[model samples]
Structures are given as C-alpha cells and as structure tokens.
Target: MTPGARVAAAIEVLDDIEARRRPAADALKDWGLSHRFAGSKDRSAIGTLVFDALRRRASSAFIMGVETPRAIMLGAMRQVRGMSVDEIAALCTGQAHAPSTLTEAESERLASADLAGAPVHVAGDFPEWLEPSFIAVFGEAAVAEASALAARAPLDLRVNTLKGTRDKALASLAHLQPQPTPLSPLGLRLPLTSDGRGPALAAEPAYVKGLVEIQDEASQLAALLAAAKPGEQALDLCAGAGGKTLALAALMQNKGQIYATDSDGRRLMPIYARLERAGARNVQVRPQRRGGEGLSDLEGRCDLVLVDAPCTGTGAWRRNPDAKWRVRPGALDQRIADQDQALVEAARFVKPRGRILYVTCSVLREENEDRLAAFLAAHPEFKSLPARDMAEQAELPGLVAFASRFGEGLRLTPLTSETDGFFIAMLVRS
Candidate 1:
C-alpha cells in the first residue's frame, strides 16, 4: 500500500475506534481481516500511523483545529510522524489504493504545523482532567515525562534464575545483542524499534523453556523489593497473571511457599501453567470465593506480602500508548479506591513484624504516595521503610531519587529509571 493509503487506513481505524466503542487493537484486527489484500508491510505501516496518532491524538487534533479522523491523521503526519506536506502529497497522488489529494484546508493546516513544542491544549497527550495530577506528580518535568509515556518502549526480559542466569541467557540470545539493564541484575534491555512485530523473545528456547519472561525492569525491581528468602512464606496478594509471583518464586528458589491468590480465579490459571514450565514447585494458588474470607489461614502467617495492586497504568503508556488516551482523572480515582481495598485486604495476612510490598504501575501521587500514607495512618503499628535504604539492602545498584520519595516506597519513572513507570513501597507490621 502507498503511504497515503496507510494513512487513510489509520484514519478509518481511528474513526471506528472513536465511534464504534471498540478497542484499538480489535479495530485494527477487523480492518486487517476486511482488507486482506494489504500485505504485512502495509499492515505495519498502517498500524504505525494508527498508534502514532493515538499517542498524540489530543495534541494533534488541537493543532489541526479539527477532530475528524482525516484532520487528526494529517496533523499527526506532520507533527507526530514528522512528515512534510510534499512527501504526504506525493503519496496521495492519483494511484490505485492511494488516498485522495489533500484539500486546501488540510494543506493550509500542514503549513502552520510548526508549533514551538506542544500547544497548551496538546501540551500532554493525556486527558485535560489529568493535567493537574500529572503536573503535580511530575512537576515541571511533566511534559518530558508524558512524552516518554508516548515514546515506544523497549521489550524487556527477565532471566528466570530458577532456569538460567542472566549471563547464560544473554549468551544464548547473542543474535539480538541484548544488554544488561542498569538496575535489575536479571534484566536484559532489547532494542526499541519493534519492526511492527511483537517481541521475538517468545521464540527463543530460553523463553519456551521458561528461562525468560517478558517483564519490565522496574517491575522486576518491585518484585525484588519483597526480598523473599529460602523457607519464607510470601504472598502476592494481587498476583494478576503471576508475573511478580513467578519472579518471587525464582527469588525464593522455589523454596518455602508462595500463596499466590487473587480476587479473580480466572487470572490465576495461566500462572499455574507458567509455574509448571518454570519448574516452580512452591506456588500455591488460592482462589478466593469472597473478598475477605479467602486465605484465612494465611492471617499473620506470611513473612512477606506483595500487593501488586491495580491502578491507572500510567507508567505503562509507553507499551500500551492507547491507555493514555482512554485514562481520565475519574478513572484514576477509581483505581486509587481499588488499590486501597486491595492493600487493606492484603495487609491482613502480614505476620507480626512481617513486611508488605505495595506496588503499582503508576506514577500518580494518589496511587503511590497517598496510598502509602493512608495505609500507614490506618495501621499505626506499621512504619515506613526508606526505599533507597531497602534497595541498598538488596545489594542493587544504580540508585536514583525517583525511588527515594515518601520514606517508604520507591517510585520508578521512565525519565530516571529508563524503564516502565512503577511505584513500590515496603511496609512492616509492628
């Protein structure tokens, strides 16, 4: 497909996403099925345009003074995709499958596309309601931080120490030239250019054998914050899909027991298989029928409790850029409520003097610092631990101030950590 056709396809997909109430990925899949004649390259080109537009949609629409799919696509081509009017015009020539020529209005808009940076309306790709929260959390660096969220993230893989060491796994994947992530010992940073294909690590023998798992370096760091040791009882209270649970199992060397439970049983099924593949024998999947009754025996019995609570997922926008467009301030508040419930419920299982790790894939204050403060207030017996001091205790290097806030939890942002945005707080039971 010609470049103009790709842009046209993206516009169509965006329109469906805006009106049909379908997800971006689903819309793209439907588009692909309907247009099977479009080759892989064409599909990829179209996908790139669609995602780029989604990443900067708010700003693109504001700059173009038009919210129609066509106007947004044209503005994105010039502002976000960095295309010139001439280049786009050539693609829209009278060729089969090519888009029609740019109208005079579009041409004029393209001519004035050179905004100094981002206009106030398009300052950040996030919703207008979140501008204050984002600015509060990120301060003067909010734009740069939000831009990082819009930027494409590298595929990160954590070598399962239970199956293989990072060095050995790195050696096996020499074809990819994966490099060590500065903070996490087991992490390998893959290239950022995705080639429109998902991360190829799944095809590697290491991945197939459960020697590696696709996890952000910051996530791995959050799991490490648990500091689970041999013969210790650890619990991943909100172990969705068991990514952190698996990491914890590897950290514990599959020893002792990890009571992996979530409010939803369906989310735990995949973890059972992954545990088997990783040869992890220590994870016990406990499906709770009710919110508070499940894991009654675990009350005050766990040495370490990890509440990997759900949140707005602001930190993960780099990977799922569409989330930035969908998330609103009210949604963020709902997430905070969810986190509070999950944290309160999970804290019940902490043994006397046991530690609980509260983690979120968000940089928002409510989800990070505010939650910790509320938890500490609710449970006066618990005290905050300095995240930097705790990280040092784990013998991890490459310390930064992002993780030094709140006197209890560590906050990891893309600007400082070069990884997904994550917040982790360790609380000890008095």
Candidate 2:
C-alpha cells in the first residue's frame, strides 16, 4: 500500500477506536480482518501510524483545534513524523485509496501551529486530570517526564540465569544487534524498527530455549531489588504470567523454593509453559482455589514476599499509549484498592524480619509512596526498609542514587531511569 493509503487506514482505525471506545489493538485487528488485501507491511505501517497518533493525541488535538480522526492523523504527520504541510498535502491529494485533501484550517495549523502555548497536559500528550499527579511526582519537569512517557519504548529482555548467562544469551541473539541495558545486569535491549515495532525475538533460538524473556529493564531491576537469595523461601503473591517470579528464580539460582500464586488463577496458566521453557525448577505454581485458604501453610513463614501490585500503568504509557487515554479516576481508585489488598495479603506471608517488596508500573504517588505510607501506618509491625540500602546489599549500588529521590522506595521513570515507570519499596517485618 502507498503511504497515503496507510495514513487513511490509520485514520479509520483511530475512528473505530474512538467510536467504539475500544482498545487500539482490537480496532486495528478488526480493520485488518476486514481489509485482508493489505499486506503485512501495510498492516504494520498502519498500526504504527495509529499508535503514533494516539501517543500525541492531546497535543495533536490542541494544535489542530479539532479532535477528529483526520485532524489527529494530520497533526501526527506534522508533529510526530515531522512531515511538513506540503509533504502531508502530497499524501492527502484526494487520490484513489488516499485520504481526502486537507481543509484550509488543517493546512494552516500544520504549517504554523506550535505547542508552546498549549496546557501542560496537552503538551505532554496525557489526560488533563492526570496533570496534578504528574506535577506531584516531577514538579517543574512533569511535562518533560510525561513527554518521555509519550515517546516510543525500546524492547528489553532479561537473561534467564537459570538456563544461561547474559553473555551466552547476547551471543546467541547477536543477529538482532542487542545492547546491554544501562542498569540491569541481565538486561538486553533491542531498538525498535523504523516502523516502530520490535523484532520478533520470540522466534529467536535463545528465546525459544528460554535464555531470555521479554521483560522491561525496569521490571528486571525491580526483581533484582527484591534481593531473593539462595535457600530463601519466597512467595510471589501476585505472580501474573510469572515474569518477576522467573526473574526471582534466576536471582535465587534455582536453589530456593519460590511459590507463585495469584488471586485470579487464570492468570497463572501461562506460567506453567514459561517455567518449563526457562528451566526454572525451583519455582512452584500454586493455583488459588476459589473460596479456599490461600497459602495458609506459608503464612508468616516466608523469607520474602513480592507483591507486584496493580496500578494505573502510567509509567508504561510509552508502549500502551491507548491506556493513557482509557485510564479514568474511577479506575485509579480501584487500582489503589487492589494494591492495598495485595500488600495486606503479602504481609501475611512474610516471616518476621523477612521483607515484602511492593512494586507497581506506575509513577503516581497515590499508588507508590502514598500507599507505602498507609501500609506502614496501618501495620506497626512492618517498617519501611531503605531501598538504597537494599540495593547496595544486593550488589546493585547504582540504584542507590535513584532510590534517594523517593521517600521510602525506588522510583524509575522513562525520563529519569531510561526505563518504564516502576516503583519498588521494601517493607521488613519487625
């Protein structure tokens, strides 16, 4: 398909997403299923255009003075793709299968509109209601931080030490030109393609052998900071899909018993195949039976309990730009409630003097520091552990400086840590 036709396809996908109030992936899939004539390359290009348009949706609407699908696509061409008015016009020349010609206002806006005067939320390409949360976290740099979240994310992988070393995995997957991640000792990063998609690493020999797993560097670091050591009995209370559970197994060198369970047992289904592929023998999957005593045997006996709490996922906006728009105040409230429940449940499994690592893929204070504060206040038996001290003890002293920015935990952001937004706090049972 011509570039013009791809742009038209993107506009259609975006319109479907808005009209149906559905996910971008679902809309794109429906479009692909209906328009089977479009080849793989055309679908990829259209998906990229659709996602890029959503990434800068607020800014695009602010510049174009309208929020229609066509205006968003046109504004994205100018602002994100760096296409000039003439260049955009050439694509929208009313040719067959191409978008209609741009209106005079669109042409003028594309030629001269700037974001300097736009509100912070519009400039940062995030929801207006989230402005205060961003400001609370980043202060004067909130817009810059939100801009970083709006940008594309690189693909990251964590080497499975239980199966192979990072060097071995890197050498095996060298065809992808993977680079060592800045902070995670076991992390490998692959740059996105020009079309803004990562390589199909799942098809690689290393990945097939479970030498590497597709996890963001921030998540790897969060597991590392959990500091699960050899021979320790650890519990992953919210082990969805077992990404961190596998990481914890690698960190423990497959020596300790790591029990993984989730409140929603269906989410644990994929962990079985993943565990077999990764050769993680030390890990055990404990599917929670409905209305049963959940891990009652391990209550107050575990050396470590990792609660990868649910959150708004504000920090992961770079990859899930559509979620940035979908998140509402009610959803955030529900997530906070979920986090509180997860933390309380995790605390029950942690042994005296053992640690509970609370993690979230959110930069919002209400979900991170604020939740920690509330947890500590409600449970006097648990004391907050300094994340820097824990990082140093775990031989990741580089994270100490980063952890200092937060009150009682480590916060990683795209702008600050070149990673997905993640918060890690360690609580020790006294």
Candidate 3:
C-alpha cells in the first residue's frame, strides 16, 4: 500500500480504538482480518502509524485543535514524522486511497503547530490524571520524563550467556547492526525503522538458536543487580516466562538451584520451552496448581529471591503507548496491592542474611517506593540496602548515580537511563 493509504487505514484503526475503547492490538488485528487484501508490510506500516498517532495523541489533538481521528493523523504527521506541510500535503491529495486533502485550517495548523503553552499532560502526550503522580516522582522534570516515555522504544536483545557471548550475538546479527546497550553488559539494541518496525527476529538464526532473547535493557539490569552467586539457592517468586530465571541460571553458571514459579500456571508454560532452547540447567519449574500447596518446600532456604512484581507498567509506555491512555487510577491501586503481596510472599522464602531483589517496570511511587516502605515496616527482619552498596556488590557501580531519592533503590527512566522505566531495590533479611 502507498504511505497515504496506510495513513488512512491507521486513522480508521485509531477511530475504532477510541470509539470502542478496545486495545489497539485487538482493533488492529480485527482491521487486518476484515481487510485481507493488505499484505504483511502494509499491515505493519498501518500499525506503525496507528501507534505513532497514539504516542502523540494528546499533543497532536492540541495542535490541530480537534480530537478527531483525521486531525490526529495529520497532526502526528507533523509532530511525530516531522513532515513539512507540503510533505504531508503530498500524501493527502484526496486521490485514490489517500486521506482526503487537508482543509485550509489543518494546513495552517500543521504549519504553525507548536506546544509552546500547552498543559504538561498535553505536552507530554500522557493522560492528564497521571500528571500528579509524575510530578510527585519527577518534580519539575515531569514533562521531560513523560515526553521521553511517549517516544518509541528500540528493540533490545539480551545475549544468553548460557549459549553465547554478547560479541558472538552481535556478530550473528551484524546485518541488523545491533549495538551493545550502554547500561547493560549483555544487551544488544536494534533501532526501529522510521515507521517504527523492528526486524523479524523469528527468522533470525541468532534468536532461533537461543543466542539472544528479547528483553528491555532495564530488565537486563534488574537481573544483573540480583547478582546471583554460583551454588546459591534462589527462588523466582513471580517468574513469568522465566526471562530473569534464565539470566539467573547463566549468572550462576548453571551451578545454583533456581526455582521458577508464578501465581498463574498459564504464564509459566512458556518457560519450559525457553529453558530447553537456552540450554539452561539447575533451574526447576513450579507452576502453581489449582488448590495445591504452592512452593511449600522452598520455605526459609533461599539465598536470593527475585520478585519481578506486577504493576501498572507505566515505565514501558514507549513500547505500549496505548497502555498509558487506557490505564486508570483503579489499575494503579490494584497493582500496588499486587506488588505488596508479592513482596510479602518473597520475604517468606529468604533465609537469614539472604536478599530479596524487588523489581518492577513502574515509575509510580505507589508501586515502587511506597510499596517497599510498607513492606519494610511490616517485616522488621528485612531491611532496605543502600543503592550504592548494592551497586558496588553487583559490580555495577555506575548505577549509584541513578539511585532513588525517595528511598533505597536504583531508578531507571528513559530520561535518566535511556532505557525502560524500572525500579530495583534489594532487601536483606537481618
């Protein structure tokens, strides 16, 4: 399809999403199913435009002074794609499948598009309700932080040390020109195309052969911060799909026993195949069974417990921009409840002097610092560790500069770390 046709389709998809309040993926999939004539590339291009529109929806609407899907597409062309008015006009010639030619108002708006005096929420392209939480966490830098989160995220792959080194993986994917991530020793990053598409990793030998795994750089840093020692006993309390569990196995040189389990058995199903493909050893799966005693045998014997807790996922907005719009205050409350429960469960397995590495892909204080503070208050036997000391022990001393001012932990945001938003803290059982 032509780029103009793709833009038209993306506008329709966005309209469906807004009207039905459905997920963008669901709307996009349904659109693809109904319009079978669109090839894979056409569908991908349309999806990219739809996502980019969503990413800058607030600012786009503000600039165009309209919230309609057509205005969104035109404004996004100016703001996201950085197209000149003439450049955009070429695509909207009102011929064939192209979007109708922009009206005089739209052309003028595109030419004079500026967010000079817009509200922080509009300027940041995030929900207005989230502004207070962002301000609470970021102070005067809230707009900058949220704007960063509203941008596109690059693809990041973590080299599976159990199967290959970072250099080996880099060489294997050389055609993609992947670069080693600045923060993560094991991460290789591939920039997306201008239209926001990543390489098809399923066809890549490096990915298929288990030399690399798709993971955000911040997540890789979380696993590295755990710093699991060889021959230690560890438990991955919420090890959904075993991303970090496999990393722990490699870090332990496949010498330590790592028990991976999640509250939902369905989430744990993928880990088995991933473990086999990655050639991971010394890791056991404990899928929660219906009404069954769960991980009872793991009580009070773990040297390390990793809680990759659930949250609102605000930190991952760069990859899932629609999520930031759909999220509500109730979701944050529920996520905080879940995070608190996960910490309580993690504490049950840590032996004396053992540590619990609490991690979450959330920038909200209610999910990170507040939850940890409550956990520390309730569990007197556990104490928060200084971020500096933890970083030094993990051999990632550079992270101390990003230590949390709200409490004990390392805070990584797109603005601060150029990675996904992640909060990682360690609590030691005294």
In candidate 2, which residue ranges exceed 4 Å CA deviation? 404-406
The true-versus-predicted C-alpha distance at residue 228 of model 1, in Å, is 1.2
Candidate 1 residue-wise lDDT at 183: 86
lDDT of 3 by residue, 16-50 (tens): 99999999999999999999999999998898899
lDDT of each: 0.81, 0.91, 0.91
**TM-score-based ranking:** 3, 2, 1
Flag clash pairs in model 3.
Answer: none
Q: Report the Cα RMSD per candidate.
A: 2.1, 1.2, 1.2
Q: Write the per-residue lDDT of candidate 2 for residues 1-430, one digit (tens) a residue.
A: 8999999999999999999899999999999999999999899999999999999999998899999999998998887778889999999977979999988988999988889788889999999999998888898898899999999999999999888788998789888999999999999999888778999866788989899999999999999988889999999988999999999998898997999998888899999999999999999889887753668899889999999998899989999999999999999999999999888888888888999999999999999999998988999999988876878877998898787365898989999899999999899999
Q: What shift in Å separates residue 138 of candidate 1 from its native position after superposition?
A: 1.8
Q: For candidate 2, what is the TM-score?
A: 0.98
Clashes of 2: 0
- Give the C-alpha lDDT of model 1: 0.81
Clashes per model (N, Cα, C within 3 A)? 0, 0, 0
Query: Of the candidates numbered 1 and 3, which has the greater TM-score value?
Result: 3
Error of 2 at 33 (Å): 1.3
Number of the top candidate by lDDT? Answer: 3
